[model samples]
Target: MNSFEKDWRFTRNSGKGFESAELDDSSWEKIDIPHDWAIAGPFSPDHDSEVIVDDPIEHTRKVFSHPGCTGGLPHVGKGFYRKHFELNLKPEQSARVEFDGIMSHAEVYCNGRYVGGRPYGYSSFALDLTPFVKNGTNLLAVSAENPPGASRWYPGAGIYRHARLIVAGRIHIAYCGIRVRTEGNRVTVRTEIENPSARKVVLTTRLIDPDGNEIASCQTSGDRLFHCEFIPDEVRRWQPGNPVLYKIVSILGDERHETGFGFRDLTFDSRKGFFINGIPMKFQGVCLHHDLGLAGAAVDRDITRHRLNQLASIGCNAIRTAHNPPDPELLDLCDELGFLVICEAFDEWKRPKTPRGYNLLFEEWSERDLRDMIRRDANHPSVIMWSIGNEIPEQYYPEGPEMTRRLCGICHEEDPSRPVTAGLNNVDDSITGGLFDAIDVKGFNYKPYIYARYHAAFPDAPIYSSESASTVSSRGEYSDRLFEESGRKDNLQVDSFDLCCADSATIPDHEFKGQDDNPFVMGEFVWTGFDYLGEPTPYHREWVRSSFFGIFDLCGIPKDRAWLYRSRWSKQPTLHLMPHWNWQGFEGKEIPVQCYSSFKTVELFVNGISMGSRTRNPKKLLGAYRHVWSRVPYSPGELKAVALDEKGKALAETSVFTAGAPEQLQIDCERCGNMVFAVVSVTDRNGNLCPHASERIDIESNGKILAVDAGDPGSAKPFPLPYVNAFHGKCAAWIRNPGKTLILAKAVLNGKTVQTEITAEA
Candidate 1:
């Protein structure tokens, strides 16, 4: 597998004999396996060229006229990946191939024979390779077809996740077939094994904690399925901010394998919000897409860990994989980091959100897709709920209720330990009235106005905010107007501190109050936690191609709005100052100074002079809390904010100064194994980040550059290169095996080159 991932023959153009055993692939280019052929493309506006006609399949989707044309990137075609490997297994042993995820449609071939295939990209599937394999060298081929206009956002092409090959005895534990549950001190495990020989076998399962202590052991005899129960002396339950995991090793006829599991109980009520282990807890959640900025859809362990750490720093305790299932590594990270997850299955069900979406194949493939998702992720402890669909238009149709019920039933039958839910956006009570009976939990998307009415209609239903807060803003841009609707072309979004909604349908300021006052409303998952690659909102022809709904920008830099959530969710005393003190046009006139803090009193100062102090007024804020000094005179100096407790003691203090012209290039690199992530930032002479700097920098490295990313979804610049224009004063570049002993990065900004080195270890 290591050598197969290192080098592979890839061709974007398909042919009839490409999957044959004797076909010649010598002319194909050598590339890596976890690659997005579409992402590494010659990007242009012409690529977003999907047209909607009057036909049944084409008429259901919407048209676009934005800069990127709404396709996001040039990943709308077919490609092939062929690799050679040696499989030396006994005739009685079996071999199989497992794919975490593929793009849209994927087919597999071994040696020369055709194997099984999977159509949906988000659902993980497997194929048996024993029948088609030889004892020694064998050729493996895979073809991926991703037609344009199939999705509303950018879905990367080809195999964008981890792939592995498993070889075991005739009877062995199946992939992702173990489910564990804990009730007080008792641990129950259900294991399913595959036995093509139809022979009964004895299976032994043992539970080992992180400290290498064996807590329980049991054995069972079965040909296909078995259940084992045991009791431990002490139990530590998994909860928010405290994640405890255990390893389960299964032995079936000499076959050995292990998986990570945890013990926790999740319950919900209309009157008590959410509970974990009998303690009430709020869901501080954020919706996240699968793409990792410039890294595309490929799953990198360090990259995912870095993103989760950033979200955790901002006080987020849960994540909602918006509209689709996520990479398996993401769920693993949530388990290790103590984040609850709502694993979603599909974005569209029977109704097309685009010209060619999942609806075109829903009837034939939905059941298999949903079942596969549950089987693959049922073992993860971080998953508390399985979301069937998101804002499906079926909610308004006559058959919507039955469709929802069928989907929920499938989820429950597959794994009943977790409840099933769907995101309903229909604001009409009559239309969505029957959906409550189909699901155990009701997820409302962008319909906060109907909370009271729906609660009265169904007193037993548990309510959750599947998606909320579509506030739009660009990093470092400021406008004095409280709200702006003209996010049209040529209008860059307001400053990171100012939030504006697209229409009057939602006032984010008022929604927070509604959630806090109603016990029936458990918690809200914001529309986005980070800016994703596509579906540019408040879009205009002249604007960039990505979204502006994230609390943090694409580069993982926190916008001022992040402090708004941190003030309310974080337990630590926090104080933050926004809109750096650099306003050239309005230097003397009154400037609006705002501070997001949890403390009761906040004092404002400008250049060592005290402006005034004010206490937080609950009646003044509708959304999150913030202290506003609306009429402070601006100057070219330092601005500071200090937060004090009720006893007048200082809790925390923060300061922001007017940055000078960009003078230096700073590099912060994190090395995980052979991978290196070099975060490049433009800074002033004093080392403070210059948010306004947009300098074109030339990067020359002594090692391999994986991808150079700036988090600007609108930019058509080629990545995996040596040069990029910093967007909002920041960009990132991923390097592989910089050096066996040392890695060097040299950046040239404004004709000055600075070099940095990282001491690497094996």
Candidate 2:
């Protein structure tokens, strides 16, 4: 029997057998684990996009109002989860209940007594329920409350992760940690096994090659300590370009466990950069957050694999699981797909606390959280670094050096194979140097200017622009303008490009745009790879919002920036076209248009109506273009541009553009403001803009007359002055006002008239 079946009983009431009274079930909703409670609740619409405001105070207020900001257990009101399991525990069998993750806070009760509470959302915790559980029925109740202290970013609540009832033998291996160190052909494999049971047991360890061939095996008799070593004629080193992994499987009687192992020696030499497998390898990576688009907090392995595939296609061989530990599936995928991973622990420097309506830092909780994270994810071979925190508030704690050191110590003690690092936002000399002693690597967030100062201070320390962006900074706050401004101003007294480049002349041949420092400066993890959901505000919604940090949209559509990354990273011959219009303007004859494609050979055609084709010109074919031409025409209908590869296989096609006279415009108006808008644009049968169009707009309402002005025929402008009253009932605007006291008429765009008959209060 499994651990859960051996220790716990099956019961009907979630609150039964616990120390406290059963929670009220009236407001409780029955739900499954790995669920996002926000999707089930009625959060405001503003909780769906990024916040664009500048003021920090206003940003805080807006952040708190979103569902993702609400902390505590999954408290979108009150929710309860209860499960009953029948367990027949043998005399020597042991059982424990493990929750892989719970959002913010959770109160777990096993058979009535309070088992424990977890505050850190991403870390996993387990409870030994052997004592409390009975033979027949076990009642497990979980009360989750979503507090109002969470961040505006999406924190899908409830048991938004996995839950497993584990069962083991009395002398089973509780935890196993393997640390591999290599010097030349001699490899040292340090293994630590914790046997909580009192009895003694024998364990066998085997190192298997990639093809499942046993390279080495060792048998040790002990429940508490097990050490092994292996030496082979040829060692396969794992690196970014050529990732080779080996498997180490441990067998304890009938139970078996396996973990991937990479035989690589890593060193951080200030002069040579980071070296893996004794060879310098730049980390060409991207930072990825946990949330996955509109899918909320659900763990869809296929979706994650698809995203990783996309990242791989773009030449990103490494990923930094930013801010927190990602789903186990992500690590597994990385192991299988051969990508380097930096598993992160926390977002804040300290444990997040809710005191007086604000989220505060709890130091003790922070240490515990770090301990839990390191202990949990220490086995993944793909993980090379243990990132403690991400962009924490440095000003809050002046002794940031000490705090970082302590965190690093905790990580090292737990798992020393991986280096400890944090994503530092403040690149000031003091802050960077303060963390230098603690951090194994110097990781800067959007601070390419400080690289030189850091290298100058500690020339031997491995430095990297942990996070960098060409257009916008992470968190969607700063833009590319900030980088340029700092790059141009010699006031900083540094060579911006020299300090920022991730690659150098000594490295492989690559492009060197002004202020473009990558690979040479080690490497940079772009802000994000995919658009995530939540963090909605009024400004960011109603359009393509959701952090705007990713290169791809929520629907998996590659944004323009994605192309830029591809061009820089992949350097593969490619073609991308963005027409002035969508597939909405095509008639019998081809119309004059512009086409953008990054290809050696290009041909333009509208619905099989071939225009002209271009061969490799290096400059013209690869750049954006606008050309006037007439070609084979199509019947009055929609038109689409299609691009073909050298093999003539269609690479991409645009949406069909409709050909015909454009639809008439529709408009609406209110008392405070006169409004005019068009639902559709007027176009010729060939989808070209119609010529010679004019419209008159007028606004009339019961309120006092406001100033009026006509808008350009080209622009869909609102009525002059008051369109909708700031504080009043609805009003109207028409194409032409008929001076009737009861009727208000205003001229609108697209040659439309809006008339509203109203009765004024007497």
Q: Where does candidate 2 have its weakest 10-residue lDDT segment? A: 503-512
Top lDDT prediction, candidate number: 1
Residues 1-762, model 1: lDDT tens digits:
345476778998756777887888888988876777777656665665445332222235455455453435678878888988898988679999888888868989998679988888877888888889999889989998887778777788888887888888767788777777667767788888888987889999999987778878888887898898878777788887889988888888778878787878888888778999888888889999887766777777777888788788878899999878888889999999999999999999898877678998899999988888888888888999999898887877778888888998999898877899888777463245576578888888877767888888777889988888778777666654344453433454544554465443344555676686676788888878887767566653443556777887766666777888887788877787776676778878877777878788988889989888889666776323677777788888889988877887877889988888777777877675566767778888898777766677665556577778666656767776666877767777777773553445455555676655554454
Instruction: Record all residue pairs in model 1 with backbone atoms less than 3 Å apart, i.e. clashing.
Output: 477-495, 478-495, 509-622, 509-623
lDDT of 1 at 403: 88
Tell me how many residue pairs clash in candidate 2.
62
Task: Please estimate how well model 1 matches the true structure, expressed as its whole-model Cα lDDT.
Answer: 0.77
Off by over 4 Å in 2: 1-32, 45-78, 176-197, 278-280, 350-361, 395-397, 449-458, 470-519, 535-545, 583-762
Query: In candidate 1, what residue range of length 10 has the lowest lDDT sum?
Result: 50-59
Q: Report the lDDT tens digits of candidate 2 across residue range 284-391.
A: 678887865444575555557767877887777789987687887788788777788888877765433222111243454777777777666655657788887777
